[model samples]
Target: MNKELEHRFVTELENNQNIVHKICTLYTNDKSSHNDLFQEITIQLWKAYPKFRGDAKFSTWMYRVALNTAITLYRKSKKRIQTQDYDSVIYKIKTDDYDDTEEQQLKLMYDAVKQLGDIDKALVFLYLEDKNYSEISETLGITEVNARVKMNRVKNKLRTILNP
Candidate 1:
């Protein structure tokens, strides 16, 4: 890549590293695995950056690549994620926005989300991130209706997990 393209890619990746870390956290059980997955996603992003067009927002384009990288590696793994350090993975939730009860509920919800299948977990994560159905569809390569329907099913699944 040229200097300008390299510079741009680094800048964008730096700005969006949190997105990659979040995906890594979702997919991996331990800090070691999380770091590995993050590096893999970054490498994949850098390799594919040349083909990225200006058609969509950089972050929007990133979701597709990052999610795919996580899912693909997840499928290739032999063992399930054993355990996640909830404190380590969950950086923080402010007291102003959420009380103790709400924070506990959020942690429970995250645990439930972790039980979902890989694709379902990705779907739920994107939905929780406030992505619209259109963006979710585009990111996951499904139709808008499919994204909405899957989201409804995911919500029901989470409810069952949390309430039972």
Candidate 2:
């Protein structure tokens, strides 16, 4: 890659690493699997970077790549197991806008969201990341009205998980 393209890719990756991490967390519970997923997402993003036109926001495009990569990327191992236990892995981190309770709540929310089916988890992830209905629809290849309906259902599902 040329220097300019390399720099742009690095800058974009730095800006969007959290989204990759969020996807990684949604896909697996083990630290090794998380790291593997993160690397896979990063590799997929880099591969897809060359095709990114200026039609959408960089973050929006990045979200699509990450989601597609998460959904379609192949893993060699078949023995990996899914676990729903986030209680032992939960932690609170400081954010500019969140208090301790909010931080904890966010972590717990991710835990609950992680328990959702793959597609629904992707819906909730995009929603939490502040993607509008149109962006979510484009990313998931669904209609805008379907996006709205699915998002509403996912929200209610999350509310039940968070409040119960």
Off by over 4 Å in 1: 79-103
Clashes of 1: 0
Local distance difference test, each candidate: 0.87, 0.80
What is the C-alpha lDDT profile of model 2 across 67-143, one tens digit per residue? 77776642333345545456556885657975578768777887898767667888988987888888899888899
Candidate 1 TM-score, true structure as reference: 0.84
Q: What is the clash count of model 2? A: 0
- Candidate 1 lDDT, tens digit per residue, 1-164? 69999999999999988889888878877778889999999999999999998799898889889999998998887465456566676676666855589768777877898789988998988887889999889888899999899989998998899888
Give lDDT: candidate 1, residue 73: 91
Top-TM-score structure, candidate number: 1
Worst window of 10 by summed lDDT in candidate 2:
73-82
User: How accurate locally is residue 27 in candidate 2, as Cα lDDT from 0 to 100?
Assistant: 70
TM-score of each: 0.84, 0.77
